[model samples]
Target: MSDTYRALTRKYRPTSFEDIVSQDHVSNTIKNAIKQNRLSHAYMFCGPRGVGKTTMARVLARTINEIDSSIDGESLNQTLNIVEMDAASNNKVDDVHHLRESVRIPPQNGKYKVFIVDEVHMLSKAAFNALLKTLEEPPEHAIFIFATTEPHKVLPTILSRVQRFDFKRISVDEIVQRLRKISLDEDISIDEESLHVIAKKADGALRDALGLMDQAIAFCGDTITHNELLQALNVVGTDRLFEFMECVKDHDADRGLELINTLLQEGYDIQEYLIGLTEHLRNLYIAHETSKLYLVEASEETKKRYQQTAGDFSRDDLMRMLHIISEAQIKLKDASQPRIQFEITLLKLIHMERSEQLSELLAGLQELKKNSGNFVAPSQNGSTQKEVKPEPEEQAEKVSEPVDETESTEENLEPQPLNPSTDSEAVGSDGSSPGPKESEIEVEAEAEVDTQIEEEEDDDFDIGAPALITTLARKARASVQSEKQKQTAPSNGAPTETSSEKDLPEKITTEYVQEIWVEYLESLKGDFPMLLHLQMERTKVKKVKGGELHLECDNSFAQKMLDEQSTDLQFKLKEFTGSVLRFNISVGEIDEKDKPMSVYERFKQIQQKDPIIRDIVEIFGAELEY
Candidate 1:
């Protein structure tokens, strides 16, 4: 007869409390209970599959029944008193009655009779009720132990009667350590990286680790490398997945799609590949913020890879990618062609750019303020102050003194004028030299003071009008342009010129046309928020062209919404502008660079010949949709 090989997982199954891996707390607690003579009549163990819950239960049975422990040549045989049942297949009321009857009589030789039921939650309601009476009040010598992966499905009455212990998922490190020991004892040669892969593939299950290791050894002829492990499990390695993620981050859609196609050609499951990629990204996210990378349950090399990859992405980008992948997962299941779904999802990820961080936006604003000199400091009177310094020539002209002719005139005045001299003498007194008059000096001082005050007031008004308008326009334009760039930059650098042109109308400033468009937009006050908001932001009157009034909005959604309500909008605009204006909606995002100066600034800059936007800034803070 030919000898058969036992699987490593079954051959190395935990037989004693000390042999169970990654479950010291549970095993130690059970051991102490036995030692203290405080064992419960009914015990429940619940956790994920292969975490040693059932194994612990079996060990408990053997311990209580006093079965021989001869694995390590330490025999402690006393008597057999434990019976095990698979409740999944035998969940009938009759089965429960049979079990109850069997537990009635005491063990033939042992002190306690133990019954171990695996998957106890699978028992039908009738079976559970049938077993309840015996479970609640069993004989002093009887013990009932139940194990289940899902404890919520178990009857509450049965649960209330039993002492429950919840089990935890094993860490990857624990699984790796157990596999290393097995490899050593079994004389199988495998690299640390291969062991890491197997452990991760096991996903917090020691038994699963053993099983995978057994399979790896068998398939790879006793020596397993990282590549061998990957082939055996069909896993795309961490490095390739990270490369794919990098491509996505860089907006390289072609490269990302190529990677997906390559993996699919390698016989990997599309869904499983996506799921693994999602997990890889999640780990990277966790690693980005944490110094304790080891706690992520990856090998040293894998942890390093994660840390390096995490440095390439912002947290927001990683989160966005995770969301996209998750949504793709749902769509792929019912998709007509799963591969196409994956391709489309990959393209989306690769072409996706992270939204500008609010910090970056604020920083840009600060930079613009520094460049444009728009910041105004508040004055003592609570009004804003603007400092102005005149040119050297202008200053010289302002502070120059008037000629001093008063002294000359006084020298020419005759002494007879003091004694009320003749009329001829008084009239001829200043003929040779004129004397200064008090009224003339006073008039000159008052005129100079008035001129200085007027100049100061004009400077303040000049800064206030144009500066305020320019500041508002620049901000509005920057916000709109940034958003537009984000939306269009990933689409091969093609600007949305068509959409921009469609939203702008030519020569729509005539009073008749202006009134018509205003009435049209106002009519949509209740019907469309986007149109209303757009109108609120737009105040300039563009000249009408081809009987159409053009207006700009911040985004495409607003543009589309306005387009849908064009007819009603056109009629109202005609009424307000006094022209039969058709609608030409220009969805041009703001151009920060081309924004005109404020009205006040423009007036001051008449010498500079800079034109100002000829309208008030429209302010609409309310939420609107078009």
Candidate 2:
């Protein structure tokens, strides 16, 4: 054993440009500049720590002065021509003043006196200003080189005066290659997995990797295994992360809790464990999305494991899991009991319902809607009836559930008409009159069924088959009755005698026009596009005189939309009142009282129209906000 032993980081420090690892871009560029004699007076080398920034600066300083390491100590610590300064220790204006005075003296050995400043960003503002003049125009024999982990902190004034070179973090593979070479040169017997763990723990910093290797050698002697290295480094094992993810996939909350207990009991840092778990999830996501195992920084066997586990979760579920894990990572720092918080976080992942794609959810809803239309309702006698097409006059006679025979009168069976003032019905293409009010009832029934399913969704409960069947059956019945009513109404071919034929209105009154306007909106409920129906809902009947029907709206956009549909509306009115009335739609101040009610207010008002909506909303344990 050596008493004056050197740490691996300091022992393996590169002496020349060629000896630096994974910095070819910077080394090549600087070498070309030196060959061309185009060296900038001030150069800034910046990047993450241990990625060879300061090392590159030192090499550049040595190269500029053409100092041969064989003669001039390889460490460059004993050189007279090269000056090294750490800005962190001496960052005052007086330090810059001292440096300014030192640079005035010519080099004693080399043509150029090179100055290397590390952690340059730590300099005070006053120091940077004092150094800025020296940087802008230094003596022909003096050269300044700056290295910093954070270049953004340096003043823009100082940055503009220098030629900047950015260094990148060494990749895991490169770090592993470097570690392997060092291990072989030093006669260390270590497994490949242990080397990989050290490289990954370095996080793209070769110096850190070397330091970790030194620690491993001290703890595990000359021989190192993967398990021993993990313990020496205090890192969580990858197996624990893999097992936790499996528990999440299978929704095994109990197993997830057990994994958390084991992790804490093993003396793993809660934050470090979370970070490793997050990385494990990221690997799974990459495998699932790109199917490129190389994108994940793991061994071949671990990549294969990721590939296999990737199939268990969809991309949407993986994204959600990542989001939850990221939030927990942030919240873990403030948690009073980190173990409890970690356990809760794992349980949340295990209990999380996998997210379904939007298209899949919509497809499911459509399939349910289609199936609901065919569902049969049970009668009072507990017998199910198969719905069949009805005869013309007997259309309204068929009902879904049994009722008292006495209540089955003509008045009870007839659909309440919206247009009580007009006798003529809007004739359809098939020669029968379509009942506008009946279609409105059907629309309301459909809305009720939709709300019921929504209520179930809000409660986080699956739409029960029984509840859906009942709601769908009611909707189906209403739809069928409306369809039959439209088909069975008296057509132009049939000259049926009616009270309207005997007593036709001689004149169009405001009241008559208003009633007809409501029926027009009701008629649009099912047959027309919703925009037209909704627009008509917002209109107010302002006036009706001398064959002119005036409608008012709040905005010009609404007025324009109504104006476009006015001609068709006029035709509808002619069919009802047998009058060619002109529609005058204009932007005007409509009274607040005339505006349509909000959905919640309307539902409350129309509860009597369909009490089942209120019942379903309550029974499903959801508030009908709309």
Candidate 3:
């Protein structure tokens, strides 16, 4: 190493506020404080490393003492009164005590004594406590500036005593500009792309950026190229990134996996590769999302390349790729076989489009199945075709034909409810109260109506177009009543009756209904499979009172489904119970703990009550955090 050699970080470190990039806020505040002589005795500088935290503290020390223009670089660092302490090394209670003892002494030459402590958060609990009192009430001539990456780790007591200035990360443009200026001033030959690579490698740390540039210059001799800088830094090339993305676009998982193996063979970090891929996908997503390139932090050529590839993917496909990579990265930490896990996740991306297509096809089939049951669907080649128009004039004539006394044409205008407990008992035309004989006549009439309706129903029927079905059902019900009157019209001026309750099942009850419910559910399993997701597995038959059986479901959604299917469900129940039982469905309250709260539901509740949070939601387009 040459004796006169100096690292670029030390040589080009900002000496004045104007020289610091992207730190106008910090610089402006400190300048006003020093100029006005209103500086705090204890001040805290907090931010990420190499964003002018320590450098700002040093500049403040010299400027406050009015020695900034007089002191040279090497001598300024070794000055007596302007003491700089590395808190990482001298963080014990004794070191703090010794400093505390020395704080009482006045400056030998300068008007003020300045002590700058860097990484002050590294001090022990005892050291902080010992320094707290001194920090609160320091000597008038002594100015203490504490610099820390983590201001939160410092005691609140210490923080309260000092005026804290929080520094922000320098922007990429600013960092790049700084690197360019340094390269020009130092007579180094490097392209803009190489400087950007160094700036990105620095990650907002100007010290790190200059250090990287110094290393690049040393390695490349004089002219630093992008490829040499990438090799020197051991980062994967843009070519590899593009190639990997192309493999995905072509849906070639085998080639992608081979590329991954090659990267591993070259001793590249899996995590780096994963991050690089995620960033590339993010750039592509941005390109697809907007016409503006403000958000993208890459060269014009790189942006054009991303733009070219961006159209090759949809937003959904890009989001899926991002999700897969993010999940893999999270799982990669605890994974014993990280490489295998990565391979699986990448292969999942390759197969994602096909899987989504299959999902859509299955969904369509399910929807068709649901609606097909409601209609007499068309057959291929117009097979099973039927023209359901019967002769209207003949039907009207038959309807207008008067019936003889032997067969009563009494039309039951309003159909009686088919509830076993209170079904209308067929009475005589003379207004005789209904008895077992009348009930038997009604039962026989209903059976005949069922058979007649079945023979007329054809494949052209549409339930959604319900005019025909509704008319048919009404006509079937009217025919039953007319038949009931015929049976009870009295043969030879005397009504005839048949066998009664012995032909049907005895007494309908809630207990009997409950017994057959499980069997009914089992029958439904072949049809409405979505009902299996229902939480109300144990629906209770509350009672059979007032002509209706009351059933209670534990969930409102389940109750609604049951109510909608009540006609079909009650039919099944009656087939087992042997009675025309009516039903009233209700939802009962379940335990609050049993009904688990979702984060979204809670967020909705909160949003309803808190208008400020609602406004924040509207302003930011923020969703509920899980």
Clashing residue pairs in all predictions, respectively, total 36, 0, 2
Give all TM-scores, in the order shown: 0.58, 0.61, 0.59
* Residue 530 in model 2: lDDT: 40
How do the candidates rank by TM-score, highest first? 2, 3, 1
lDDT of 2 at 515: 71
RMSD of each: 24.7, 17.6, 17.6
Model 3 Cα lDDT, one tens digit per residue, 134-230 = 9888899998989999988998889888989998988777888898887777777888777777877788888888888878878887788888887
Give the alpha carbon lDDT tens digit for every residue of 1-626 in model 1: 01488877667777788888777887888889989999989999999988988788778877776766663211222234677788999999999988988888888876888888989999999999999899999999999989999899998998999999988998877788888888888788888888888888888888788888877877897778888789988887887888898897688877887888789889999888888889888898888866657567677777878887888777767777887888889999899999888898888777765544443444344434533342356778986654544446534433332322232234223232323454444355556633334334333433434344444443444321221112222233334334434544546776555442454445456564554444454444322222233443453555666766666654444455556656655654543444456767765655776444332333344534532322222233211110
The model with the greatest lDDT is 2
Q: Give lDDT: candidate 1, residue 580.
A: 55
Which residue pairs show collisions in model 2? none
lDDT of each: 0.67, 0.73, 0.70
Ranking by lDDT: 2, 3, 1
Please give the range of 10 consecutive residues that has the lowest summed lDDT in model 3.
526-535
| Highest TM-score scorer | 2
lDDT of 2 at 244: 83
lDDT per residue, candidate 2, 182-282, as tens digits? 98888889977777788889999999999999999999988998888899999887777788888987888887787788777888898898788788888
